[model samples]
Target chain A: MRDVAIIGAGMIPFGRRDEDTLMDMLAYASLKALDDAGLGDKSVDAVYVGNMGGGMLQRQTAIASSLVDRLNLMPAAAETVENGPASGGSAVKNGLLAVASGYYDYVLVVGGEKMREVTGWRATDFVATMTHPQAEYPYGITLPGMAGMFTRLYMEKYGVTREHLLAISLKNQEMGTLNPYAHVEMALDRGGIFDSPHAIVNNPTSADPLHLYDLCPVSDGAAALILCPLEMAKKLAKPPILIAGFGQATDTQTLQERDDPTDLKAVTLAAQKAFEMAKLKPGDIHVAELHDAFTILEIAESEHVGFFKKGEGGKAAAAGKTRLGGQMPINISGGLKARGHPVGATGVAQVVDIVFQLRHELPKNRQVQKAENGLTVNFGGFGNNVLAFVLRRVQS
Target chain B: MKKEIAITAYKCKKCGKLHYPYHDRCLACKSREFEQIKPQGNAKLLTYTAIFNLPWGFDQRFLILGVAEFENKIKAMGQIKADSVDQLKVGMKMKPSWEPIRVQYGEDVYGLKFEPME
Candidate 1:
């Protein structure tokens, strides 16, 4: 096996993109990555597209092949990977291995989801299709519903409070104001969202215990990355970010099947494996991006991934330990909370954000000071499937 | 439509372990042979959520879903009966009852739901 490095990363602004088709968004992001790689007219060996609801939402399938054709990169091996919301992470993992094995020198990985084309109810139902057909979906369960239950349990067992959740919402949204590519660019005032007399009317409950503000927005966007063997990456104009380690794990399809409902076992296992392969501990990571589809998820995954001790994640966030310029800053890209979650695009966008941070290309306010390493956790199917990646900056 | 409220599980002939919502083969021993067995009624709730925003097919304004550990310790998820979401509590003992859990295909879909035991 050989080492693989990300030579280029690109992202389109995330929001309700009504003007672009799924293929168009994918092609644009791919072109941006190709341009960033500075490989004018250079051929890519294969293309992997990560998408969860292209068919259901756009009535389109075979996106990878369609994208390669759209970009005039025909004859390249094309495949679409779908692992629910973690599809992007899964695609990158495949591309990483393909390049690492020396079989493919250049692999283009792009993830995009155009969900806003459908109604909110339809999108909610579409995502819930990942749940147990007989046990969960039949009862009208959605991702927010699952997160609400998990949050309630975490609160009772771990002593997490709404105040802690409020801190994450406030911080991420504030950071969003600084991120041009973020879906939500407005900052949240504590008084408006929580302390005001009209708070309940503004941030009504979507799921009991988890208000609307606590959940990520359903977004439409795309992100891409170009991967190649580390040796080839050395000659590139930009500093390469090595894919040091990646791990994927699976749990019971239904959260109830697990012995402990609050425990994200897959998150813990995948992070541990990634750390072992990277030869770096969580403490060594200068920046991190956790799956924050729900604010509680960011908190739970932080602990499960060893960034904080169990039950301490919420407190740590409240204390600004996970904010920019703080000790071990996390979600400096604003996270899924404010950056938006276009399911398939989220995982790749996370890596792209980390790449920017490691390369010191982000604005000073959002950049982690002298960041060298970053971590990302992309969760799928209510923690049933999860992927984690550890990336390091290579000093040329 | 009338429905049975009882919960049925599959017991592996080779390993003697049980499975809920039954699988094709025993996860423990990979035994293909299994026998149907009804789970014990004593149950403890793990966690639950009251979803106010109803999905496409569900008719209820709010759906109360619960995850519970049965006497056999196998975890399962199902809708729970409650007049209000506040009445539901984690770790509370409950008994199963039969009712229409939701409206599907333009008709009520009957399923077993747990209720706080009197």
Candidate 2:
């Protein structure tokens, strides 16, 4: 297989975009990526769109064909990939495969979801669909509920605390303030974060121990990436980001059936596979974009993915090791907590942040100096269906 | 009404795997042959949650109780319907009982809930 590279990446600001349609957001980001790649729409050979809740959120189906038709990319094959919240990452992986396997010279991958268009309660219900239909959903087990359970178990078994989880939110919010594309740019104080209005209302006791501030916001946004063979990418873009390694894994969908809820076995396996393929270790990564849909998730994920020893993730975050200018910066793009999680768009948006970091396009205050290697973790349905990728900056 | 709870599950005749609540096929062996089974009363609660909010159709009457390993070693979530939420804890022994979740149109959706087995 030929080597694949990301020539360009773009994302719409993550927030309530009721004024814009899904196609409008897709077009905005896709056009930006195309422009960044210095390629016209005619250069694209195929399109892959990732959307998890378009049918429930927008009452729209066959989103891929519709987007291709709207973009006027006639005769180009378009397909939609749905893998719960990891749809975006799945789409990008598929696009990379298509370009690498010689099926297409260039592939444009886009992921978007207008979650804020629906009522907050309805959106929660919609997101809850990702859980096991018979076991968890009927018991009023939403994402927050599941996260809370996992957090409780992790804390109990691994000796983590609410303070450790709070530190993650504080750090991400601080990094997000420097990001122009972040949804929540304001810095959050510890007291205010534990007592703020949004936190009080949204973070209310969804379940024991996990308050509202511990979760990510419902957001609307879209992200796009242009992928092509390494040879073609070098001619089009300056310093293309090479996809060094990609790995995906699956776990038991039902939380109860899993051997252990606190341990993310799928994520561990995927990361190990990716690292082996890339001939690198966790220490080689200079920056990371973790799927921090909840504050506790960032802590648990860091440990499960081998970024830190088990139970040490919370201490690492609390000590500011995961912050910018620290040992290894994480979530400089605010993460899913403060940056916003638009389900389908979250995975691609994470890669956008990595590309920016690798190309030195981020604001100086938040940029990781001498950053060369980056990794992204995108998971669907708690621990089920995890995708991990390692990217390296092409040195001239 | 005398409150009673039991661990309820759908047992697959082909694989003998027990599943909580109800399902058409056994997740373990992908079998359609199954029998409704309720393990004997009183089992340990593996974990739980005290939900402050209720979803659609659920009135603000009780806190949701997510119980595990009740009688049949099956996990399920249901309203406590108890007097207070302070009584719940991890590893607490509880009994499973039947309660009306809500009336959709005219059909009563029965939910499996757990009560303190003191």
Q: Highest lDDT: which candidate?
A: 1
Question: If candidate 1 were superposed on the true structure by all CA atoms, what would the RMSD be?
Answer: 1.7
What is the overall TM-score of model 1 with all chains considered together? 0.96
A64-176 per-residue lDDT for model 2 (tens digits): 88887888777788999998899999999999899989989889899988998877668877888887765567666677777766777789999998889889888888877
For candidate 1, write residues A1-396 as lDDT tens digits.
Answer: 898999989999999999998888998899889999987788799999999999888888889988988888878999999999999999999999999888999999999999999887788899999888876777778899999999998999999999999988998999999999999998998898889989988998878899989999999999999999999899978999999989899987877657687899999999999999999999999999999999999999999999999999999999999899888788988899889999999999999999999999987898898899899999999998999999999988
Each prediction's TM-score versus the true structure: 0.96, 0.92
Q: What is the fnat of candidate 2?
A: 0.36
lDDT of 2 at A243: 84
Off-target runs (Cα >4 Å) in candidate 2 are A195-203, B1-37, B59-62, B82-85, B103-106
Clashes of 2: 4
* Whole-model lDDT per candidate: 0.89, 0.81
